[model samples]
Target: MLERNEALKVIHERHSTRMFLETPVADEDVRAILDAANQAPSAHNQQSWRFIVLKGKYKEELADLVLSKAADFPKPSSTLLRLASRSIHSAPVIIAVANTGELIARGGDLFNIKDGSGVDFFRIMEIQSSAAAVQNLLLAATSLGLGTVWLGVLVLIKDDILKFIGEPKGEFMAVIPLGYPGQSSRGPKKKSLEAVIKYFVDE
Candidate 1:
């Protein structure tokens, strides 16, 4: 195998997976994924990210909660809602990610101010840190030939999910489902760089 440029291959191959096989992911693989997540860099090294892995009965409970919320919406609700409900039960592992939140005092010290704006900045940093960790987690899973999907829809039932996971008041970020692929495909093509990116250069 060509060792050089393999990271780019992994990045290009990783896609948001939907359907998954019933086969179980090995415990070692799960641990490796988490280890990759833990290695992500954080603002001020606070490492505010936290995770809750749901499998077996816990996965069932997640589907129940999401479905309960979906029922309140219009009939034949969003496909995303349907997918979110199905992912928990269908995937071998579902990992819930959140932020512990920056300590009020730390935030004040970081920004050198004791004000609400400082708190806001701290909150954003917390999310950024968690997001980086989650990206690492996804890439690692992809390298291991595991399919994964980042389910941000979990934020819809944030309160209920937090309570279920026993982390009341935690900033729910996302739920990631991982397993062997049963059915999945790369979604719509991404926009060209010229269409979305703006370059500012010194002239």
Candidate 2:
């Protein structure tokens, strides 16, 4: 585990990496990142996240799958999908995350939800839990000196991707391309902390 300040530094340094070196990430680092992801807390402790790690030909296959499926879409969307799929080749590894459908059944059992009325709430919980795990993954990669980008666009072809990866029952969360960065980045601009914060107090 990292010290408090070291952890903060890693969090601050993390940024989206779109161009990666051909260099391969170590197997140990990948395992560490996945382990970090597994530690995330889920609603009702469902821990519904599942990960599919891709390498070599699998990366190209997944990208090709996305490219082909995305072609059926209309103008700007197809264009966007094409561009996004191309980015997959920039990294040596891709990790696809999903919500494994455990949350729905468990939440239903806990809340006595037998209809669609509470399904949305459970779905949202699943997404939130998966997202937390992804954040942990990103941070873990950053701490290990590896680069990563959270590629949520892949979810547009979620069903196809899940089927390709043999997780037909899961809900796609994000696809992360990981490797050593081919280029340096300072990260994108952001609103000032003050601008995005609000506090309330009694007078």
Candidate 3:
């Protein structure tokens, strides 16, 4: 019970941490985070996630790619784009999460669906697993007193990112930029649990 409370405290206290300190996250912590992430369950245990951790010039090159590709998309909000560009370029390290599309594609044969129409089912499960992985990683980082922010912007340039990372069989799912904080934050405000959840039952 105490450990669970401590874990929940870390989850609730973790902030988005955009203004990260220039200092790099330690290698051991990165390894631990990845170890925790690997514990996430996957569709049929395929475990399709592959992480590309970028630093120095490599991270910068990908940042350039992200910004350039952002111009190709329809900009519904220039402010959000500017924030994303900064997030892409500023981190001491960026961990790019990719999944084996081939594994997802083979789901029909692997999961024994006759018509193959259930490929979407497996794909969705894989994506959920990927999300679980990211959550585990972020929570681990928080527990280690490190900070991270998820870069949703990278999904806009998934093709370019996969090409840059040289993962031909991979599909980009998320980018996470990480470091110690240059500035502190108190995490995002949220609606109460009652606002979002309701009991369902036969009336």
Using TM-score as the yardstick, the better of models 2 and 3 is: 2
lDDT of 1 by residue, 1-203 (tens): 24469788887778888889999999999999999999999998999888898999988888878877886666445556777888877899998898887543488877678656677778888889999999999999999999988988767678888888878877888889899988768656878778998989998
Candidate 2 lDDT by residue in tens digits, 1-203: 34479888898889999879998889999999999999999989889999889999999998888788777988777886776687687789999998888878677778888775888899999999999999999999999999998887777788888898888988989899999988899699878879999989888
User: What shift in Å separates residue 11 of candidate 3 from its native position after superposition?
Assistant: 1.2
Which pairs of residues collide in model 3? Answer: 21-182
Report how far off residue 5 is in candidate 1 (Å).
0.6
Clash count of each predicted structure: 0, 0, 1
Model 1, residue 145: what's the lDDT? 91
Q: Name the better of 1 and 3 by TM-score.
A: 1
TM-scores of all predicted structures:
0.91, 0.93, 0.89
Kindly give the stretch of ten consecutive residues in candidate 2 with the minimal lDDT sum.
1-10
Give lDDT: candidate 3, residue 189. Answer: 81
Q: Largest lDDT belongs to which candidate? A: 2
Where does candidate 1 stray beyond 4 Å? Answer: 1-4, 75-79, 103-105
Query: Rank by lDDT, descending?
Result: 2, 1, 3
Measured with C-alpha atoms, the lDDT of residue 196 in candidate 1 is: 100
